[model samples]
Target: MHEFSLVKSLLRQVNEIAEQHGATCVEEVKIEIGPLTGVEKILVQEAFELLSPDLPGSDCRLTIIEVPLQAICNSCGKSIVVQNFQFQCTACGSSNIRITSGDAFRLLDVTIDTELTTGVTEP
Candidate 1:
């Protein structure tokens, strides 16, 4: 489903980055998951586990960073933040609003080490 496609894309990018630095193994993979992205954490983790084995990085660790939902009111133009999927104007009861943040999924950073012949390096 959605997880499959997203994971496929993520794996491709991860492998490319890992190969760029002559890295034979990736130690960590950090990704940002926005609230409006509508992605399940467990499903994403499962997909990564299932898909990453065949790639360049064998023992890669996947870390997900969840972002909260934030919106702005169209009437008063007030900024409002919510932990979950709640989008309503606090100052004015306006249903007409725009999402200022959240609704994106991106690979923020990756950790790979190729110089180590025995163990991975820390920086």
Candidate 2:
């Protein structure tokens, strides 16, 4: 599945971030996924489970946040949370709506553990 490739890329990115921060271990990786992102959540989780161990921090946790599809109506200047994949605006029933979110999979943030000179770990 494409989720495997996506997860692989995500791991690589996380690893880079960890290295940049001189992290002793990666703690958590947070991501946001939308309904239209075309990636399965379960598949992504499975892929992460399969591939994350290859990285420095095998115990890194993946946090997936589901975001709602949201849009703004151009006609009425109203913000709406789209339901059932409906493109029409709810406030004014306008088809001229601009999607504001829920269109892609995005990396939100990464938490990494760093070692202090005093021989202690901090995040």
The top-ranked prediction according to lDDT is 2
Clashes of 2: 0
**Displacement of the residue 10 alpha carbon in candidate 1, Å:** 0.8
Candidate 1, residues 1-123, lDDT tens digits: the string is: 598899899989988888888887888889988778878989999999998886664777899998777788889988877544556676787867888767778899988868766676677
Instruction: Report the alpha-carbon TM-score of model 2 versus the true structure.
Output: 0.91
Report the C-alpha displacement of residue 102, candidate 2, in angstroms: 1.0
TM-score of each: 0.79, 0.91
On a 0 to 100 scale, what is the lDDT of residue 81 in model 2? 95
C-alpha lDDT values of all predictions: 0.82, 0.89
Model 1 CA lDDT for position 48 = 92
lDDT of 2 by residue, 1-123 (tens): 799988989888988888898888887889999988889999999999889887675688999999999999999999999999989999889999998889888999998877678876666
Model 1 clash pairs are none
Q: Candidate 2, after superposition: displacement of residue 37 in Å?
A: 0.9
Best by TM-score: 2
